[model samples]
Target chain A: MKKLKRSARLVEMTQFLLARPHQLIPLTTFAQRYGAAKSSISEDLAIIKEVFEDEGTGELQTLAGAAGGVKYIPKMGREQALHFIEQLCEKLAEPNRILPGGYLYMSDLLGLPGLMNEAGKLFATAFAGRDIDCVMTVETKGIPLAYATGAELNLPVVLVRRDHQVTEGSAVSINYVSGSHKSLHTMSLSRRALKEKSKVLIVDDFMKAGGTIQGMVDLLAEFNAVVAGVGVLVESGEVETEQRLLRDYVSLATLRAVDAKGKEISVEPGNYFSRK
Target chain B: MKKLKRSARLVEMTQFLLARPHQLIPLTTFAQRYGAAKSSISEDLAIIKEVFEDEGTGELQTLAGAAGGVKYIPKMGREQALHFIEQLCEKLAEPNRILPGGYLYMSDLLGLPGLMNEAGKLFATAFAGRDIDCVMTVETKGIPLAYATGAELNLPVVLVRRDHQVTEGSAVSINYVSGSHKSLHTMSLSRRALKEKSKVLIVDDFMKAGGTIQGMVDLLAEFNAVVAGVGVLVESGEVETEQRLLRDYVSLATLRAVDAKGKEISVEPGNYFSRK
Candidate 1:
């Protein structure tokens, strides 16, 4: 394997840890893999730690004693976790989401945490070993899922605002089309929110046209940062374009919406978490 | 110290882990203090682990190695930590917070996260060993501070909404009159959100008339929960009545409203987070 630069190693580290939460890896392992000193690795961890805390997703822990290593645990409470899964079951039972025409009401599912937190966990689990700095999500509905994912990883969540707020000041803006709306929408990030070359896990509530996802990909590039991973809360199982994005794309819930008389539907877990 | 009940011990354990994170404790010691079996202590730790994971605070980690036991790390990242404080400072600095003469405008500062998070951490650091299950705040503005406090402890945030939302279902409401407002403002909590006998830490952005804090106390009575501690982001240094209600209070910044000339003001850290 080719040696990765410090920034690239940082992205890889974040992605690795996010993938397998609650499993600790010794600092020496990362140092060995990156061909960097343990102290340098520690410094990188500190930067990742700062950004994650700022964003509020998953957290990094320095374990003590021999055999101690870092681990990432998805932050899902007893009530909140049960509430989410129950809601998923309830939402899946809804006929509108299971249209006989094989179309799902994913917009509704995308906004629900019952399904979203799973996606967040799976994504975090997938990148558990890679150095992921922060989880980035675009504005509006994506915020909740983003927050949940960030919380699990003990990382801070940096929101990509669609419009500039006076409080956020001048922002770095990008343009993309809505898959559902097909109309163009702009996504922006506060210049102060994300630093150059930070490793980011890109997540969204749902992926339809994926224009927004593509826009985010471009935005990360503009900042000279790498896109460590891309995951979604919901994905339309039948979409061809979403399939072409990557061979390894993951989704929490796949809806095969069937629209007929009264509508019918089926729901299943996505491959993101299962891959691990 | 009096031997606390198993439930209280659990709450205390959770609260302790929530604060002074990343410090380890032996199972034998914890069991000895609580007068419970080692197995029971293990089970209590499990419950706390589940709770913290669910609430998104940090994590309760147990090590089985020869030198290992359990430790809590305030898992949320440094940015998450500092961002909240900066927010409070900025909000407290607002001009309207300036009172008549030399007094600072503080209404906005009362519920801000930057201040609240700092105050919350200060309290969390001090009461790291007490039994605190929830962080309670009165309606509207107080919610932010409450959420900040809850975040530090990895406790679930339950807001006392001012108006009932269909989303929250039926709620228990209370009325209060503060020095700032005479008309009774109502605070409500969904009956389903809080549990009876919970050890709660009552927190608010500001305490002026003491009416809002009193109303929160009354609401706690309705739930049969215990008040573990009380923390305020900023306290009116001039108020004697509000000062009397504090068991433990943390003030990131204090203000004494000035007269017309704006010449005199007093500010300092509250006793809550001071190193003994």
Candidate 2:
């Protein structure tokens, strides 16, 4: 058989994969398209696969069996995810993030995808083998990251609002104390937003005093849903109250804030990227 | 020259691209490395390039000069970025996102990467080809997206805080109102955090009004820096002030809250992937 030229073979391989997402394509088809040996197609697959994997930006899966073929799954690995969050935390620890009245100026973190992607990936992996129907997060800040995680898992994400809007219809409201020790603040979720018995992964941009998270836990109970896990992008280590409520928690960085001189310390977890 | 078997050629090509970050590799190198004719290596490069590009997760740069080579730059296209954000905005618009008070629930957006990666790419593209010395964002929510944008641009990110911290060493502070009009807020930046004459890109998770964004703009002016761009993952048409402040603005989704039925609408921008 005449061997197909390499350029033609490459184009055929790309076309085959692009046609199907999350589905495997056999080597034989590529070889047949190029009139080259199966071995030639395998070589083409190897090159394509390596570039995606090395970038830690996408996935190329090689299925080895009678149905063996390669599939590209856009995925971020555990290590890559952690490394990304750690870097964000380090930047967060800088003095610039501290706002008056001890608040962190977090508008940027709320919008950033690199940090959000890593944080989402870390939490997603924790619940990977579990049955999670949806991702739950609070508003203003958590929206971007939750949206990211939901897309990665291909699951629908539901938001829990703090106020009752005329549009939300009926909502189950929970009264909680504000972080500033003000009057009881109300956190609510739409009655129809969560499905009964659905497993949920709760995520928040920042955790302090456990009031908002606890409110979410209460809201999940309102629907008879299961709280699968809890994740936070930034957890204030200085605040001692929140640690007691966390179960299966992943924090991108810990905030060590010094009160007197206004100094802050940051640390990243080692598990963000795989060592091997 | 004799061409190597297809399998061996692929493995070699994959390994080579993985080691080089942001640098382009030419087809000729593969021919020389595998002792294959230029035509053969060209075939391999074409195949590999197509797969990565089709995924909308990474970039492939083809150079024609003798000094030029095939460079695989890890990036996401504009359309993919817009699609991901549009999906998130749709989720956010649900009546479910409304809480009891006038606040949004955004935990899901912060935890999702597939979405965040897209948002990050869009922000990176907004500032592409510009002189951006550093990326600045406030802490907590904005940190992750800022890091993602910085990583893509290969630049260092600076975090701004709300208050003065001794650890960050004498920060400059500015007070601004919250977009929600809930309270007065302060934004801070370490006196030494940003260098003078630097070009900065401002990014965050959500922009309700231009309040926080304006504060950051003022802070940059204090540092004698230029605002290269302003990017947000979500822009609330509910609040319409941010559009006039940025020369370049990109968002995955726009929130148009209409009527009291709690009905909201969203759409992704086609330009997110068009530039690539």
Candidate 3:
């Protein structure tokens, strides 16, 4: 790359940082790329850092010394996050989104990139400091949200399949009872998808009695991976507290009730808002 | 929102545009947000537009007059795309990635957000001008890639499941012959996942005999949707070309051969390089 003016460098640097979140970039790398001095690169990064924090887009952390450089940490302000969660609640409250089993048809919302990006950022902010080797989710709905969070954290996502596919090669399979109905369900992950003794963050779209999450946790046990943390987009508030399978997890929203006859639904921000 | 200075305004505006790719923003939105005049907003957009195009990040398109706002059309330069594809081919060529039945074990790469984001940008660039309302792919492996492409295109991703789930409500199921073996396969999409007569972009992680892509195209017919375009991350060249179920699709890489016995594989940039 040719040397660029400060203005152009700022723009390019911003793009570069935005593309790579939670990954450190040494100052010399930027200096060489822009054909500028390390001091000049540092100055540009300072400006970017200021703008990023001011806009509540993220944090640009500059580590000092030889092994240190700069890393972009994607974050959302409390006010903005609250607004986004409120918007999500509004969308979730829509009447047509209610399904027969009190399951709330949220695949549409889950599929929207805009919403997923917001959710991903929120999860990233919540788990920003954790040493997560990968984001794990069951196959299907949670994949997008997992990918979104992984994108923010610049980590790989591992999907736990409901049934093992031959294409995955050798795999680890486990059967567990689901929360909602106590039905026997099998979930599996390729042995190669995860490493032994790695730290993992588990995430899911919704939790009902925490059965599915427990299944994931049990599956992780087989991999010898530790659960760094767990995050859920929504946990069923209607489920009796005693029935909840996992208590040490973060949630973005709580589904209090769903009256199919009245076509009504109630949602509130999850523990994410209250947790420090 | 507080008014911003030009420097701050440029940074915020860039973030806004990048976050909402393919969506048009009226100039007045920026003017009001920054408490700046339309002319100043226009100038900021020009600077952003210049850098966006110059860096091959994307195209900043501006519409004139009342409803006019800048839109970010995510794109990857040919050089960058080639480099990315080559890197992907190298990864794919690894002997371990070759699975039984000539299947490429690409879920790991697909799960990596960094790789998926790049592939998303490449597909976004290839289909930037197409009239696409949403992206479609099968469940499991293709979900991340579909979401990645959808994220770049600023569209929703519709996942067609290999089997119908009760949670999805009413779904349209279609059975198609998959791959060279001509085995029977079934795929389904929720009735609400797509709208009638919408233009859809089909994407997948890998293509062998193009059966799955064709199945998605066939499934789209049930919804009265049109296949605007098809993109695969890798297409198997070892499969007899005549055995491919469909043509007229873009592939980022081509798997030339996979000699599982010798522990060697060959992969190259796909037709995406030749297509306009």
Candidate 4:
């Protein structure tokens, strides 16, 4: 790469850092890439760090040492996250979202990339500084949220399949009760998909009794992996406290009520805010 | 927001543009956000544009007139994309990726956010300037790829479910023959999931006889939608020409052979390069 002006270097540096989150990059690499001095690179980073902080995008952590460089920690400020979730609740509360059998139609909301990206940032903010190795979610709806969170955290995502596929050879399968009906269901994960003793973060789109999440946890036990954390986009408030299979988890929104016949629905910010 | 220094503004402007790809943002928005003059915002965008172009990250397209604004079109250069696809081919060629039925284990690679992000950029580049309304893919493996492509394209993703879930109110289901065994399988899409006559871009993880992709195309016909394009991560070379269901599609890599017993595999750059 040829030498670039300070303005060009600054723009390039910002783009580079934004693309890579949670990974440390040495100043020398930037200096060399821009054909600038280490001092210039550090000065450029300082400017980026301030803007990132002021704008509530995230933090630019600099480590001081021979082997240290800088790391970008993607996050959404508490106030901004709250505002976003409030808007999400408003959207989720739309009467049209109520489907048959008291189910809510959230696939449309989940389809938005911008919305998913924001939700991912919130989850990353909530789970920041945790020793998590990877993000795990069961198909077929939770995959997008899991990938979004994985992107923000700079971690790989592992998907738990609802049915075993020949493509995922030699899988460990587990059965658990799910939904309001307490119907038995089977979920599996490929043996090669996860490493033993991995600190995994479980993510999902929705949780009722948390039986599905419990199934994932139980499946993880077969692989000797530890559950680092659990995050869900929505949780059923209708579930009785005693009926809930999981105790500790994070949710962005809580589905309060759904009146299918009357076309009424209610949604509120999840326990994420109160948990803090 | 308060006024910011030139350096801080530059970093913020870069981050802003990077996040909202393919969406036009008026200069006035930046001006108001930074409490800066339109001239200053223009200058900042110019610098960011130059760096983005020079780095081959993407292009910052500026429109003229009252409604005009700047839009970020994320792209990967042909040479850079080829280099990436070559690396992907090498990774796919690993003998250990071979499964019992000669299926390659690509879940780990697909799970990588960085890789998916890059692949998304490549697909976005390939399909740049197309009249794409939404990105569509089947569950459960292709969701991430579709979301990745959707994020890059700044569009929504519609998932075609393998089985109809009650949560998806009313849906249109289609039956198609898939795999070497030619077994019939069902796929469904929620009626509310897609708008009528939408121009959709289909994406997937792999294609053998193109049966699954064809199934998605056939299902799209139910909604009177137009197939704008199809993109796949890998295609099988073993599928005979006459037996292949689809012809027009883009792929990153091609699986030439997989010897599960001998632990041998062969992979190469797909028709994406040849099509170009």
Q: Which predicted model would earn the best TM-score?
A: 4
Q: What is the lDDT for A74 in model 3?
A: 99
> Residue B13's C-alpha lDDT in candidate 1?
56
**Model 1 / residue B36 / CA error / Å:** 11
Q: Give me the displacement of residue A5 in model 2, in angstroms.
A: 8.2
Interface RMSD (Å), each candidate? 13.7, 8.1, 1.4, 0.7
DockQ computed for model 3 against the true two-chain complex using alpha carbons: 0.69
Order of quality (lDDT):
4, 3, 2, 1
lDDT of 3 by residue, A6-65 (tens): 766777788888888998999999999999999988877877888889878999998999
lDDT of 2 by residue, B51-136 (tens): 55665546667788788788666565656555565666567766555544445656455544445544666676666667778888
lDDT, candidate 1, at A58: 49
In terms of lDDT, the best-performing candidate is 4
lDDT at A202, model 1: 79
Candidate 2 docks at the CAPRI level of incorrect
Cα RMSDs, all models: 13.3, 8.2, 1.5, 1.1
| Alpha carbon lDDT at A119, candidate 4 | 95
True C-alpha contacts between chains kept, each model in order: 0.00, 0.09, 0.62, 0.88
lDDT of 4 by residue, B124-197 (tens): 99999899999999987888889999999999999899889998989999999995569999999999999999
Q: Candidate 1: TM-score? A: 0.46
Give per-model TM-scores: 0.46, 0.57, 0.97, 0.98
User: Of 2 and 3, which scores higher on TM-score?
Assistant: 3
